[model samples]
Target chain A: MTVSIIRFGGSNCDRDAERALEHLGIDAEIVWHEDGLPEETSGIVLPGGFSYGDYLRAGAMAARSPIMADVREAAAAGTPVLGVCNGAQIGCESGLTEGAFTTNESARFQCEHVYLRVERDDTPWTAAYDEGDVIEIPIAHGEGRYEIDDERLAELEDEDRVLFRYCDENGDTGPDVNPNGSKHNIAGVLGDRETVAVLMPHPERVTLPDVGPTDGQGVLRGFEAAENGA
Target chain B: MTAYTATVTVRLKHGVLDPEAETTQQALERLGFELEDLRSADRFEIDIEAESAESAHERASEMAERLLANPTIHDYDVEVDER
Candidate 1:
């Protein structure tokens, strides 16, 4: 199956994402944001980077790009879509999900290996992990905080929409453990169970064992499973 | 033809802190401004050919709500003066 990785003007993770997909033996193509997404691709990935130089808000300008319309269309058609870092910000700004705004409590950019507990394993992005399993990934962003209303947070919890939660190096969830000060320590969330996924951490950056986190293989495997209908 | 000055106070809603205003207030205090109340506001002057001041005020109010202010987090007041 083919995976479409969208590359905006400032996207730096396109090559990383492509490499990860190639390592998993999945045919991946990097589609420019100005150009439309590939029609036959089974999955779409919005890789991380400072799109539009983070002007007028982190993903505000990129969200209004030409490719996002196609991305929204594909998502509505049940095509699995994954957004990482700035991509996650764009997803929220494009109205793909609610309350994806602003910066961390510290109001500064942070980059480090963060432990994330898999809260939902049924989604296309996390199907390889067991519920509550912790994995390590790198996150780099200024506005990585997951913000939502209390009522929506409750709904997300009730629906099991939260896909990952931040934890400490020892995999313990707590106030100081969450690296970016995200609301409820949420690192990632699944839209409509599996159709769309948005995460703050860089799974692509970690997918290679030679360079990054070993646990990143599990995330790539999860997408493979979805492609293979497993 | 008549022109009126409308003062629009676009302040954050309740429970929403205005960092910009707070910073400005601190700067004012440092500048030896002993004013107890220092609230910042924006003003816009609009020129319109209207039948009455009341009608002009109504039009200005509509414009403020529709575009000048984001009602979700800000409230604006429009004042129209007869020229």
Candidate 2:
């Protein structure tokens, strides 16, 4: 029943994820990608980092690693998988989700706290927040812009797969509040199953109460929700 | 078996925003180069032994499809030549 946080080469957030899960009382471990996933893995976190030095595009190399096949099998079996930042890139690159996280509009790395409005509370990742509720989380990346064709974006919206969108403190979503020029201000999305999710913001970064605002604690609690079959 | 070299060129699809290319274009313009537009691409050369050039091309195309290029935002082309 432990969450396995896969740590690929250059993955700096693996330890942070481990500590955050521990702080939440969720059993977790930092599993090296070469070591493979543990048999008891009930949940997975593809922690953020510049895997493979962001070579050939962010998450491109790590997404094609042999272990990702195992992760896909587990996700298909209904195990929860959460990808953050570069992990989000891997999720999309590996087809765990749709769309692409491309270069920022400014073509530069950005590190700042941003507001995200809960688009849906029915999923485990957002069970702690109500639809339309706002949460603060930090985003740090050079290629975090969400891109998809208008037609497909509409389909994803129709399917209600969008989980979060960049917004102002008052929950108003618009281009003015978009930090990286993400299409439609999307900040997070669900995979084929809601249990499989990815987001650009670093929830684990804010999960510790000692750090600052703990608005991200709810996002990290999704692991517990999945364990309880929520 | 014949030895062939397959070249794969991967580029951003038309209409997709390419900030890196834009940045490079701006730099080039600042260097006094007149260009209506500029684009960037990644090229990979693979040498392989195959039954024919067509077979080599097929294999390299598969490589491009599987890893060398991301179809979501990239368009790729493969060319093969006997080495």
* Number of the top lDDT candidate: 2
Q: Count clashing pairs, candidate 1.
A: 0
- Write down the worst ten-residue block by lDDT for model 2 chain A: A221-230
Query: What lDDT tens digits, residue by residue, belong to model 2 across residues A1-230?
Result: 79999999999999999999999999999999999989999999999999999999899999999999999999999999999999999999999999999999899999999999999998989999999999999999999999888889999999999999999999999999999999999999999998999999999999999999899989989988877777
Supply candidate 1's per-residue lDDT for A171.
62
Cα lDDT of model 1 by residue, B28-81, tens digit = 899988777555555667777677777788888887765554443355777777
Instruction: Give Cα distance to truth, residue B69, candidate 1, Å.
Output: 10
* True-vs-predicted CA distance for residue B9, candidate 1, Å: 9.4
The C-alpha stretches of model 1 lying farther than 4 A from their native spots are B1-83
